[model samples]
Target: MTVTLKDFYADWCGPCKTQDPILEDIQEDWGDRFQVEKVNVDEEQDVANEYQVRSLPTLIVENDDGVVERFVGVTQREDIEGALESAGA
Candidate 1:
């Protein structure tokens, strides 16, 4: 099963910079078990709007089965892990 987390961010956002490393660590730790993809809001405005992402660091997680969950703002590792666990990651 594949678990994917997508981050919507812009280059000029300070919080996006802060959250980037955390997401990178999560990617490194999770490896192929899960993956993180980034979408630059400035570059992908339509996609961001489709996800209703109005913030700098919005995270949308989806499983291979197509179950999805959305989170706004800077999230913690534990919270992300818990969500994945709850989603049967």
Candidate 2:
């Protein structure tokens, strides 16, 4: 099973801009531990809706054990890393 981090964001969202780099850094730093999937809300509304992303920069962490956790808004990098660690990613 693989740990996948699904990030739902939009180009027009201000907070999403703040979140983008953090997740990018996480992807770079944790390349061996997890996978990052970016979903553009404007271009992929269906995907966002399926994940119930009502806000910008909604992050969903899932694995074979199902969804490990989720975060909305501009989440801190440490919290995300902690969640990944706890999920055994």
lDDT for each residue of candidate 1 in 1-89, tens digit (9 for 90 to 100): 67878888888988888888887787778777777778999999998888888877898888877747778888888878777766566
RMSD of each: 1.5, 1.1
Itemize residue pairs with steric clashes in candidate 2: none
Q: Model 2 over residues 6-56: C-alpha lDDT tens digits?
A: 989888889999998998898888887998888998999999888889987
Candidate 1 residue spans exceeding 4 A from truth: none
TM-score of each: 0.87, 0.91
lDDT of each: 0.80, 0.88
TM-score of 2: 0.91
Q: How close to the true structure is residue 69 of candidate 2, measured as C-alpha lDDT?
A: 91
